[model samples]
Target: MPLVRSAHERGITTLTLDSPANRNALSAGLVGELTDALTRCGEDDSVRAVVLTHTGNTFSAGADLRNPPPPEALVALLRRIVTLDRPVVARITGHVRAGGLGLLGACDIAAASRDASFAFSEVRIGVAPAVISLTVLPRTDPRAVARYYLTGERFDAYEAARIGLLTVCGADVDAALAPVLDGLRRSSAQGLAETKRLLTAKVLEAFDRDATDLSALSARLFSSAQAREGMTAFLERRDPAWVL
Candidate 1:
């Protein structure tokens, strides 16, 4: 079965992260499938926009700890979203953590339900949110990024929106997304594509400038002794040795 599922309605294509047994974690398989889906959407002129969503209580539980994609692959997937011709929007009603926030940041717009939560969880895992910073740092408020990135503290959907990690949040995410989708459906394909290009230029610039270093940083950290202990403790459902 596909890790990512694609569906189309009117001018919008929806790509759902469907690996619910893992809370839609971005494993190599899932990343490759999603990248291919977006490529197809970009090639189809009928696709005016794309809605990136998921099928579980967690939008993404960060990278798949047991089967994480290569950091370079994650960087490429993020760049693909930013550079895709059609506008990419995130419709989230679940928790997002670690690299999952990068996916949210890459979207041209993101809407979440009040029940949704977010965290920069890499720190707790003895790694930095390095590769993800390409999309995240450019879009979110610096101070907010500092606080969450350093502390690995969870924040609500409202706080996410306030910090620019999300475009909007409401009691009903679908209802909040209705107008946004309607706007996309009404937009000319060329108009949306060109507009998205303008909006994402800075993000693309960051990718070009920092992706290599960040990917390397990610690889190095994930292989270190500290990260090993952290991952082990996580899998064991216990606090890591560093936890106070």
Candidate 2:
């Protein structure tokens, strides 16, 4: 029940993640509810654009390890974001880590507050970003993925936008997002769908052949003794022994 509220009005549909205590981590139910809401928005012609945001200080901390979604849910989550016809905007503030990074990358437009920071933290958690990596890395420059993935460093909003992971970064995030949504409202839904499809096709074409390579890397990363030691150290609030 990590997803707390879903509402639509005046051509904008907003879905909010409710697990603020855990920094709005993604739970199984959250994924299902979010997927369902996004699907509903896609089918409803009245919906002009989708806004994915959260209610707490942190936009999303990432997928909850205690309640991980199944592989099917993970696949559906990626496909829903990838195939959605309307423009989707991710509104980020505070700390967005791990799978939250994925959600940002999956959206058509991402606007973050100046205070917002993001990270790909799966490496430290002893797991691959997996489904998240699929959408997240493609939206960003491929070369930086290895550095961020291996280092698990937290990056600020400006750096995110500079690297192409985020589209917009500013203090007035909601204000910045307003005009973008208005522009989307002016476009024909069919045209948006076609554009999304063509663009997605082109992006996928580049990475399709390397799917196995990424997966192998993730598997090895997750299984490494260093991953386990690092994750344990993080959870225990101690310096990782694996660090130089």
Candidate 3:
């Protein structure tokens, strides 16, 4: 079965990340599937808005520690999310981490449950955010990014919203998302497209200027000895040697 699933109704398309076993980790196949879906939605005039969500309690655990996807694959998926003509809304639940935070940052709008938590954990695993920084850095509160990026500490949904990482946090995430989606549905396709373009112009500029270098940096870090050890230790449920 495909790791990503799609459904459309009333001009709204919902694409769900469905690999619950790994908390919808962004494997190569999953990213490819998601990118393709987003591309299709961009082309479908009937799809006025798109919801990017997940099926399990854990929204996404970021990269697959055991078999991480290429940095280019993830970069491409995030870029598509940013450039897709329709409005993309992330309905976040459970917890999000590392590169998953990048996905959240690329969305035009995001609503997370009050109980949901987020973290930038690459530092703990001996790598930097690298390619994801292209999108996440622009969307996040600069102050919040400094602390969370370095400390690798988790923050709750309220903090996420406060930092501009999320549009809103609510006791019921779906309830919070309803009106946002409804409003998008009411927008003309061209209106949403142009508004999204205006909102993402800076991010798109960064992508155009920095994506190649960032992807290279990501590939190098992930292949480094320290990062390999960190990923291995994490998969083994142990601390990397660098951990004090």
For residue 220, what is the lDDT in candidate 1?
99
* lDDT digits (tens) for residues 26-131 of candidate 3: 8888889899999999888889999989999877899987767898888889999999998899988889999899999999899999999999999988999988
lDDT of 2 by residue, 1-244 (tens): 4465878877888888777876787778788888888898898989888889888899888776567566557556766877788878888877888877877777888898988988888766677777576777677877777788888888888888888888898889988887888888788878888888877774455346554565566557655787777667866888778555
List the RMSD of every prediction in angstroms: 0.7, 2.6, 0.8
Highest lDDT: which candidate?
A: 1
Q: What is the C-alpha lDDT of each candidate?
A: 0.93, 0.77, 0.90
Q: TM-score, each model?
A: 0.99, 0.87, 0.98
Per-residue error (Å), model 3, residue 174: 1.4
Give lDDT tens digits, candidate 1, residues 3-81: 9999999988999999999999999999999999999998998899999999989999999999999998999899999
**How many clashing residue pairs appear in each of the predictions shown?**
0, 0, 0
Ranking by TM-score: 1, 3, 2
TM-score of model 2 (CA atoms): 0.87
Candidate 2 positional error at 5, Å: 1.4
Task: Please report the candidate that would top TM-score against the real structure.
Answer: 1
After TM-score superposition, what is the CA distance of residue 30 in candidate 1 from its true location, in Å? 0.3
